[model samples]
Target: MKLRGKTCLVTGANSGIGKITAIELAKQKARVVMLCRNEEKAEKARQEIYKVSGNTDIHIILCDLSSQQQIHDAADEYRRRFTSLDILINNAGIIAGNERLETADGFELTFAVNHLAPFTLTLLLLDLLRHSEAGRIITVSSEAHRFARFDMEDLQLKHHPYSGLNAYCISKLCNIWFTRQLAALTSRSKLSVNCLHPGFVASNFGNSASAAFKALLILSQPFAISNEKGAATTLYLAGSEAPEHISGHYFKDKKIKKPSKAALNDAYAEELWEKSAALTRLELHKVSLS
Candidate 1:
């Protein structure tokens, strides 16, 4: 009951890493509000989590990450309903096939959900988090971020052929970039923002992926870790007190790890932040480095 009076919101809390994270948080007695795309799955997971954790404070809000408008509206409604936010876990992501895809906001699907949605939603809920005694933001990035190349000219990959890996890597890279920048922005405050790579887990993560990727996932099932193990780092980051002061870092297996050179590029992070603000048409507050 460490988090008995606290409130936490988790995106994509219906399954995989998100589901486990939510359940653990609920076990710790936090008010877990799950933002999911499907009401049926969300309700089912909510009931199961409540049953297992013996915590009935689980609530659900419907929001499709692929749509920016829904994100904005969902944030608004959430803020109106909740008084404080202690933890935010951006765990939803996608790896579309070789074909190119775009969101309702006209941005690449991978970039929109994996990066832009978090960017927008986090900023929207910053005030609520700041009001809490110990605010934490945990984004589920991937180790594949090492393969990303940040090109200002082709952020959406409009100039090149569509490769799911390329887009997925770029989105994960952006997750690190956003986390670093956000941690810097809140350095003077009690809020801690960070991202992590949950080791390759045997889950439904690649269900929507390309045929080749799906086959590879099936072949590597035995080698991949379980979803419970993958959710461990996230739970530690979200619920434990050891990392209270640690911010703006990457993690794998619950320990901080160095990101790639590109992921560490401050200039690229700033540029991407500005570009994301423009694309989302959001007027953001200026962040100070002091």
Candidate 2:
């Protein structure tokens, strides 16, 4: 389906694969709402998107995914501006390395931004998304999830020595789990939810790599996909016709891939969903699937 006149919101649309995906979506005539944390950076990227695509319909709102209050305000502002939404892309994420730190909300920075922020935002947007003929939730996950499973007892990473990549891996795993849970909840609803690993995109996102990972980045950067190439799969999931009936699957290069065993566990998905609701203190009234 052509995205012409369709409204889509892409978190972290100002850079990396998210930036290219936003540009491609705009090229398809979709009106994009870029949710970014930094105003100056977002505006610069916005202008670049407009300059290249000649699509002046792009707008920006500042919302730091690391903070709960900021996410609420961002969602409120977005709802106030848009009507009849079609797509919601949860592409914002982070990796806090070298030192363990928490967001203003007292959650690990990586977990907060990479997992909880999108989870919270999606719940808030369900009402608007359900208003559409069909809605899509494209969560940008990572292959790193293969390294770790959700530690249900310590979702906050308070008890153990923190490893940045490990935290990031679990967060991405939560992304897939969230997708499955949300999709199951909306099975009879009009919305769809799916997650993807961008295939090791050559982006600056790994700059915070724990000293150990920096070497890995240097070694892998040469073989990593470019920004536009990395964005192709996301663009397809966000706008392609083939994915209309698909939901809760992990995708790469426009195809479904087998996720790790942990990602497919119904029990874990449910546990994570409940834990997330408790953490955010947000109740999502599930629509009947029957």
Candidate 3:
């Protein structure tokens, strides 16, 4: 698909794969809106993207995804500034410290940012997306989802022993389920919703992780892919016509790949959707999931 006039919103656009994705979109002449938490880093990245892509149409929205109110405000701000949203990329994620941390909303930090943030933001922006000719939603999941021991009763990980890795894995698994459920709900619309594993790129992703986890990530860097390669699948899904008609699928290396068996469970997906809706206080009736 030609992106010359497309409007794409990418979360976490200040660094790592998200930054690369935003740069490429700008290169394609897409009007890129970068949603980031840090104003200084976001401005730096935006300037670099402009220098590299030579496209000054890039915009920024300050949002800390860990907060529900911030996510809502970000969405509202987008609507106030932009008319159409052709692509919405849920790219921001976090691996919290070894200790379990909660967001301002009192939810697990990882779960709140990785899953609920996108869930809330996407639903809030659904109307603008549907206003486009063909809207797309791409979420960044991970192979780590296979390690998730999802417990529907304890979605917040409050009852279980907390491990940063485990929480992150569970959040990634939720990403897939969210993608599936959202795709099914928006089937009748012009929206294409999908998720992907970006191949573990060597970047500053685990900076907030525990010391041990950070060391492990650093040690694994020699075997990890580059940021540009990590963003390839995202760019493919965002700009390529191949996935324009594809929805509810998981991709790796830009090809549709099966997610874990647990992620394929429709029941779990539905339950997760309901739980997420309740957590975000999203009225079911407001969503035209027909």
Best by TM-score: 3
lDDT of 1 by residue, 1-290 (tens): 15776899999999998999899889888999999999999999999998999999999989999998999899988978887888899999988888889876789999999999999888888888887788889999999999876577688898887788789999999999999988887889988888999999977798878899899989999899988999999888887654577889999888999999998989888888889988988877552222
C-alpha lDDT score of every prediction, in listed order: 0.88, 0.87, 0.93
Q: State the displacement of the C-alpha of residue 30, model 3, in Å, after optimal TM-score superposition.
A: 0.2
Over 55-129, each residue of candidate 2 has an lDDT whose tens digit, in order, gives 999999899899899988988898788766789999988776858789889888888999999999988888778
* Poorest lDDT segment (10 consecutive residues) of candidate 3: 281-290
Q: Which runs of model 3 end up more than 4 angstroms from their true locations? A: none
| Ranked candidates (TM-score, high to low) | 3, 1, 2
| Candidate with the larger lDDT of 1 and 3 | 3
Which is superior by TM-score, 2 or 3? 3
Give the TM-score of each candidate.
Answer: 0.96, 0.96, 0.98
> Model 3, 120-155: lDDT tens per residue?
999999888887888999999999999998689897
Which residue pairs in model 1 clash with each other?
none
Root-mean-square deviation per candidate: 1.7, 1.6, 0.9
Residue ranges of candidate 2 with Cα displaced over 4 Å: 285-290
